[model samples]
Target: MASKLILLEGVPCTGKTSGARFVASQLRGWHKNVRLFTQESPTNPVDLMNYAFLTPEQYREFPEEDRVLFPVEETENPKGYMIPLTELHESLQKELESYRFYGCQPWEVERPLMLARWRAFAKEAMESDAVWVLDGMFFQNPVCEMMMWFDLPQAEIESFMSELADIIRPLEPLIIYLESDQIERRLREVADQHDYEWLDSLIAFHTGQSAKPNEVPDLEGCVLCLEARQLVEKKLMSKLGLDRVILKNAFTDWVEAYNFIRARVYEKTMGKPSTDK
Candidate 1:
């Protein structure tokens, strides 16, 4: 039997990567294998290349019915709109067409086929003793289980999610929302610390003005904004029937939040140390 796979999903800068790493480190201490996968990592150039093949024009020209190849649009209340991609017929058809071209389409190029691929990957990862921690805008991919982070402003989260809804919605991964005060804070931090000149240049090249800290292209699979972590916790528990979800602080206090999640993950994956100790 394969070990359980726990996925930590959230918007950019929601501490998904950092939190996953911390959790993985703790898991390793217990002799468990863990693999951290991020959409932004350069190691997975194949994934990037595949994404790059779909030019902006191709993306825009993709029939609305084919939009299942894309990510899910972010909604003000993501939990309320957790519909699976299989339900979007037009979008699924387009995705099958793309799959056929890639030669990765199985015997049945349908929604169930696509979903099966995800399950297979998760299962394979687990068999290898790897707990896959995926950090990306995966709001569209429907999985049997998921943990979505709902920590951002409503307008901002929606804006980011709209951009990727066209390419990643088919995977149907479960969501893990993180609650935060202002989504922009995370974006600004990344831009400030990392080289976001490309984004600025792109905006200036088009709009003839340096893109403001908050003005950038939307990421895929983001959804929802909550006033507090409690609201998010209540919604996930009620909607998914999961009693507890790992809730971390906003980007500003990411380090502390990371530690908290790490500790919880350790306890869950490995029982507390023996009292004899």
Candidate 2:
């Protein structure tokens, strides 16, 4: 049983994955149940939308069907999420794939189906008794990816975020934003740590600077795209107006960050001040 939805979001190497694992363990230590969802984890039933975009590894295997367009990660039945795309209404299949990927705007044909999917996710998560820890679903997936793909304006981003906020309000998510003080140092570290040979793909995916994956784009372009994205994310996060904890230098100060979140979750779940505080 999940009591709350805690979404972890930040730039690369900002301890999102590590901190998510840490927080989940902390919750468990408190005699609370928690479920962790991350991209690196096995495919979930609701993973349809996430795999719509190619990961770094999947991009390297490009020209494969459904890489960028209508991407689908193979998954066995009885998935952890327990909600399969096959169960969706037959009419929504085509648009569901596009909407899952944010392929169209909210006012377009995919709007209703897209909103339905968001509602479905939030509803299920809200009803769960365990605290669910998810990386990137609330903020990163739609905000950054859609902005980079469509070159959307701030107004458009704000509106879309508003709709999303309203849909998930029932779950009462506490967003733990993993931020870094030394942005450039962290950027370089993430790039180097992965032994990344897919700079062009990374750049193109994040910024939409290249038309196709084959085109080699310079690092400068990617840096600029990253910088621009940071601003947009900051604005959108503020607009989201959910319960938030911004952990500056989260990479080094994760213990403090985790303690803060532990208190918040305890308060929400127990409906009182946490003994942790």
Candidate 3:
């Protein structure tokens, strides 16, 4: 069967968002039902970026009126009932932000919760004809959590990703990795483009981890960390046992990149080469 899932992954400044959108557009042109889910998209099926996960006990403690105000999704995990943290009013969000899953939970708790979502998504996706263009779900966000937030060992990270690969294997998902040749220069470019505050926050996020002495003290350190991350991501991509392509980050010629990706995605889903000119 043809693949329904297309995953775009890379380190920062690698244009994953654009790649995802382009892939979705190309698939749509082919008359496929495409759903593009960027990394920050709140409606991403396989990831809960701004959602809060609460145990049954914690959820029950919420005021009865509040419980009925917003939507919540029940999960197989006894502890994981999800509510939208961003959708709630500011005051209410403040009260529950601590329960947010991404940065708030430890890896031990987060690993299963995240995998469960992937499993469910894979199963449900098989039932639909809609093609899903997902940016960052396969590697970027998960790697960030495992490496920076939790300081997990490399083996654990690989294991977690391996399990995800297995769950989605039936879909024969196509993985597109944007490869960056100039890590430091690209990071500096990103820093220059964004506000100092954003860069500062990112630096803090990388340095303020379990490791000591602020290893990622500045932009240079950030670049090093990203380089290391790219190595691991490439390693995983090489051995994922799935159909994939590594596209060099095309800063100067996005039209070329878009064409290349579109052709790859088309071949994967159509079970043959694309004849687009």
Best by lDDT: 3
Q: Comparing candidate 1 with candidate 2, which one achieves the higher lDDT?
A: 2
lDDT of each: 0.41, 0.62, 0.82
Worst 10 residues of 3 by lDDT: 208-217
lDDT digits (tens) for residues 155-188 of candidate 3: 8888999999999999889999888888767766
Runs of candidate 2 exceeding 4 Å displacement: 1-3, 45-113, 198-201, 209-217
RMSD of each: 12.4, 8.7, 3.0
Q: In candidate 2, what are the lDDT values of residues 1-277, reduced to their tens digit?
A: 2247777887656788887887788778877778888857755323345323323443355454433343244322211121234544454345345434444333342334445567777777767677778876666656664566666678877888789888877777778887765665675677666655554456656666653432334455665666676677777778777877777786676667777877876776556777854
Clash totals in order? 32, 8, 0
- Which residue runs of candidate 3 sit more than 4 Å off their true CA positions? 209-216
Alpha carbon deviation, residue 109, candidate 1 (Å): 7.2
Candidate 3 TM-score, true structure as reference: 0.90
TM-score top scorer = 3
Expressed as tens digits, the lDDT of each residue in 1-277 for candidate 1 is: 2224445554345666665566567667767876666655543211211211233444456677555545542223111111233334564544534523122222122233333334446446534645555553233222111122222454443343333332222322223445454555554566678767744642342233545444433311121221222343334334443223545545667666665566555545555532221
* Full ranking by lDDT: 3, 2, 1
> Which structure is stronger by TM-score: 1 or 2?
2
What's the TM for model 2?
A: 0.71
